[model samples]
Target chain A: EAGVTQSPTHLIKTRGQQATLRCSPISGHTSVYWYQQALGLGLQFLLWYDEGEERNRGNFPPRFSGRQFPNYSSELNVNALELEDSALYLCASSLAFGTNLPDTQYFGPGTRLTVL
Target chain B: SQKIEQNSEALNIQEGKTATLTCNYTNYSPAYLQWYRQDPGRGPVFLLLIRENEKEKRKERLKVTFDTTLKQSLFHITASQPADSATYLCALVRPGGKLTFGQGTILTVHP
Candidate 1:
């Protein structure tokens, strides 16, 4: 089966500009999560979407937001991008929530966002 | 606040040896813990998951041990090979569906 896929392998944007990243979950998966990994840093949670609803989000600012579509695809929008916003944005997908079994998340290669 | 920590330094070991990595957490009671492998410029791939009730889990050459009392997890690779070289990440899944990840431990196996 194909794993989660993300578009725009690399993106370059200037300060104060906006950037959009997209992710398509694996087939039959319903939950999509967004994370940011800065250079020499760990994965920082950004947002979680399930069944077209925003279930949770991380400590990021309001300028960082995203939405999940009906087909379970997701889009992450970063507004007013700053130099600190440069990082690899990762997307992961898992089975529907509330299941008895543990939900193992599968991730995509990620989009490298470079903010100048 | 919740915090997860993994060894920031990279580990170097010769092939055919055992590689052990550690993950520690603070201020969080997770229901399940998971390990993932990630190479440079690539996303993480799930490896193993151990629940609070289970003390240990194994898959092929990989073994994971979870200690609830200490709030830590240990991942081991037996007879490690150069192919095992990568950043191993530990993640904690809370009561809800949220998952928090550690900084990751970089393991380099030499021949």
Candidate 2:
């Protein structure tokens, strides 16, 4: 089966601009997760969507938002981007909850977002 | 608040030796722990997953030990090779599937 896939390998945006990154999860997966990895930093969870509903979010501000489509693909939107918003945005997917098994997330290559 | 920490410094070791990485966490009781390997400019690949009840799990040359009492997990790569060089990350999974990750440790194996 194909793994998770991301689009626009890289994105360039200026301060005050908006950026959209997309991801398609593996087949049969229903949970999509978004994470941001800043330069020299670890992956920080941004949002979690399962079954097309926002389940949970991280400490990030509201400007970091995303949604999951019926097909379980997801799109991350960064509004009013700042210079610090430049980082690698990653998307992952896993089996939905209550599967009675561990939900091991498979990640996409990620989109490199650069805000000038 | 939950916090996961890994050695930020890069680890260098000769090939054919065992490479051990550490991950320590606090303020959360995770249902399970996972390890991932990430190459530069690439996404992380799942390496292993150890549940809280599992003390040790192994896959080929990779071994992972989870100590819930100490709130720590140790990842080991035996007979390491240059190809094993990458950043290894440890993530703690909450009950609802939220994963909190550590800073990751960079490992370099000399051939």
Clashes of each: 0, 0
lDDT of 1 by residue, A1-116 (tens): 89899999999999999999999999999999999999999999999898998988899999999999999999999999999999999999999977533389999999999998
Q: State the C-alpha lDDT per candidate.
A: 0.93, 0.92
Instruction: Give DockQ per model, in order.
Output: 0.64, 0.66
Point to the candidate with the largest lDDT.
1
Candidate 2 chain A — worst ten consecutive residues by lDDT sum? A93-102
Instruction: Give the 10-residue window scoring lowest on summed lDDT in candidate 1 chain B.
Output: B1-10
**Residue runs of model 2 more than 4 Å from their true location after superposition:** A99-102
lDDT for each residue of candidate 1 in B61-100, tens digit (9 for 90 to 100)? 9999999899889999999999999999999998667789
Which of the numbered candidates is closest to the native, going by highest DockQ? 2
Worst 10 residues of 2 chain B by lDDT: B1-10
